[model samples]
Target: MSQSFTTKRYRRYTEEALKDALSAVGNGMGLREAAPVFRLPRSTVLRHVEDTTQ
Candidate 1:
């Protein structure tokens, strides 16, 4: 027998919102603080910030 699995696919936030969150961090807002304020995931914000600085 064979089995198949499905995963949920969706983006709850927009790219503009993500940029705003990153900007907030750039302006001194903590990652933890910026995530919820912009409705973005903390890990996502951290990842982008890390990418840009590298």
Candidate 2:
């Protein structure tokens, strides 16, 4: 029997884009809103936001 394994793919984003996303969130933008606008994943943005607040 042969088994196939799947690899998870992650979106590629520039450091500038991430900074912009986080900046938008800091400036009163919602995570959902910032994610799409900055072409970043919502979870990624959320994690950074949470980290900075701590």
Candidate 3:
């Protein structure tokens, strides 16, 4: 018998793109809606927003 395993990895979102995504959010968009648009998780988008602004 043999055993196999699988792992999931996250694709990196660039800082520049993150900034752009944050800008979109700041302009009055929901995180959930913005996630797919920026190809990022809502949490990631929010994180970038907090990081750069502070």
Candidate 4:
């Protein structure tokens, strides 16, 4: 049987972009609130913000 596969493309945010998102959240904005403005996932921002990865 022939099978077809599909892939989902994700947006790659620059370090500066992430920093902006982090700053927004740090400045008292919520994840759900900031994510849409930055066009990123709330969980993604959370991962970068909560983790020590650079």
Q: Pick the candidate with the highest TM-score.
A: 2
lDDT of each: 0.92, 0.96, 0.82, 0.85
Clashes of each: 0, 0, 0, 0
How many backbone collisions does model 3 have? 0
Whichever of 1 and 2 has more lDDT, that candidate is: 2
Candidate 1 error regions (>4 Å): 1-6, 9-11
lDDT of 3 by residue, 1-54 (tens): 887877989888777777777888899988888888888888888777788779
> Model 4: per-residue lDDT, tens digit, 1-54?
987988988888777777889999989999899898888888899897788445
lDDT winner, 1 or 3: 1
Model 2: residues with Cα > 4 Å off, grouped in runs: 1-4
Across 22-46, the per-residue lDDT of candidate 1 in tens digits comes to 9889999999999999998888999
Would you estimate the TM-scores of all the predictions?
0.79, 0.86, 0.67, 0.74
Give the TM-score comparing model 3 with the true structure, all chains together.
Answer: 0.67
Question: How many clashing pairs does model 4 include?
Answer: 0
